[model samples]
Target: MTENTVESVRRALDLLRELNRQRVSSVRHLHHATGLPKPTIVRMLDTFAALGYVVNDRRQGGYQVTSLVRSLSAGFHGDPLVVEAARPWAIAFTRKFQWPVAVAVLDRDAVAVRFSTIPDSPVSPFHVTINNRLKLMSRALGRAYIAFCPPNERNLLLRMLAMSDDPEDEAARDRDAALTLLAMVRRAGFADRSATVEPKSSSTIAVPVMLGRKVLATVGVTYFTSAIPKAEAIARYVPLLKEMAKNIQTSVVLLEQGGAPNDGAH
Candidate 1:
């Protein structure tokens, strides 16, 4: 170990990260998520509570980060410009369709959900997925972002994926098949989750947000597989999602220019 390294600090940060992944986390959930021992979690949570960065409310089902944690984000943007522009449109899409929508931005080897409308959606497939990370090959949001990104960036991401140990990303090892799949996504104008992955009862359809040739982020909606045929869902939802992406793109430009969204979008 390095002389300057502190194992306790690293573990505490890891625990904090797991806590931030969902709205609230039970000790069991924290144990499963971080693989940290129960005693360690208790110690850390108690320490965090003492420090005013966390609260343990039995009525809330578990421990949750307190607003004081915001102090840690003094200079952290958390994809603010993109997420700020996307929030209303994503919520609007969920309101109209009654299905949950999520916005993801590339985060190194995978895509991370920055915003989700599961709370706004009456028919949310999952109870919570905020801050979830999805693999680049088998997830609709990840595929959408990777498929539409510029070639140089795509190649670099593919190389990185090829080296990943995550089973969902194994397709990258078969370079031809992976590229072919991405080509199909490009041709179809959207991406769908692999049928073989978990939660086979539901699916996601995703489209990229692009400015010129560069993709800024990906957006997707999750729906029950039995509620509608895939083709019909694609026909109906893809257009709206594409339009949402366009509105988000425009909003990004306006936000960057010190203006608000034009108020013309749903």
Candidate 2:
């Protein structure tokens, strides 16, 4: 390939990496994240969509990488590094507490569940999976992430949240309320969501998994509201949840340093 072709290929790979990181992004978001021109982002997105590696999301008005991109890792047997790091701890936490757990990372303006133990939890009341996206200001996982992330990242996320298409995620548009909520979360060192964002019978508590000053993800435990009172749940599980988060973070660091084996299945 010519020099120009090599440069184009590198740019395309960079765009793909940004898309994977953000999950769904508009041309503007891609430009901001990758420092590429808007026209280049648009052209690359159009090409990716035509190639069936990306899709236009009408509901959110953004471009999302499609399952076709998984072919790039066809021989990979494990989850993403972070998810691989959390899988064992998540399962162990569920088995010990008899409550379902989920680990999520920021995907654009939402928290996307990268790992969930709901389906495997022996005591989980709901057999269904918990892989759905959570609104940034309304769910415990998202609130934990937004509250503990670095200030600049938090501000950027808040701006993106404010542009949410869902009317129910109005908390994002309410800057004052969102800030107040985040302040409360910071002070509490964790976040909770009740029937307001979830079913009336269920609730969740979440803590951030930190790597230095950055929040790698948020880990959460869910239980039936009637089965466990909020205060009791907090008293019983918060410390354990925080410890698990630390362990997951340590494992991720170890994996990064090549000091541990990655044995978990994706």
Candidate 3:
């Protein structure tokens, strides 16, 4: 990448970090907070605005962070509110189902694991890292997300799949299958089980985290088929996973609707 690109990324991150600390700021306030040049700060604000991460108040000449930024960092930001919101529900689901539970959000071509209560299991071969890609169409969590996304986004993803490469023509062959998986997940109110993405594992049951109709993330419990039958896993986990997802969605909505609590800081 070019120096400008690198600098741009740094500047953008600095701006966001500052906003997270202060809650709200104007271009001048950002400059003071970041110690970046005035022109640079303005450019960063403009870019953030364009991406819908920052909302500008023309009248006050200030800017405030928007939920879209949290959405963009849904898997990685580790926002206290998000963690506080998801952990209790995730833990409860894990405890009740007696299985490992994880929450993930889409990040470009991959799905990033945000949090997990998955205990080390010798029987299960799959391993997931926080904030890392895990294929776009493979896992139950990934498919659950795609299933709940808007038609425009879903179609765009499908179009990309049609044009993409797959050594086994896996993408092409599974196009319909992927769509089917999504449909069933929606119809059943949750993803039953999947091992198609990470072979050797018995299955993963997933539910989508919807924010105002947008699929913000997926939360699921994974278990080894050898340890438990796929049918049994699904039968045991889907309802609980669905409940946790609803709780998480409610928290996200609350965070968005609530005013800035850290007002003076930012």
lDDT of 2: 0.83
Q: Across residues 1-266, which tens digit of lDDT does each residue of candidate 2 receive?
A: 55556777789998987776543567887888789999988899899999999999879559878889989878866456888889999999888888989999877888888777875566564533435688778788988999999989988988887887886568878888888889999998889873465477888899999999999889999898888899999998888899999999989988898764564632
Per-residue lDDT over 153-243 for candidate 1, one digit per residue giving the tens place of the 0 to 100 score: 9999999999888889899999899899999999999999998798988999999999899888899999998998999999999999999
Question: Model 3 over residues 16-91: C-alpha lDDT tens digits?
Answer: 8676443346777778878999898888888888988888886744787787876866676544455567877877
| Worst lDDT 10-window in candidate 3 | 119-128
TM-score of 2: 0.67
lDDT of candidate 3 at residue 122, scale 0 to 100: 26
Q: Considering every candidate listed, which one attains the maximal TM-score?
A: 1
Indicate which candidate wins on lDDT: 1
Give every collision pair in model 3: 22-265, 22-266, 202-225
> With candidate 2 superimposed using the best TM-score fit, by how many Å does residue 74's alpha carbon deviate from the native?
8.3
TM-scores, each model vs. reference: 0.72, 0.67, 0.59
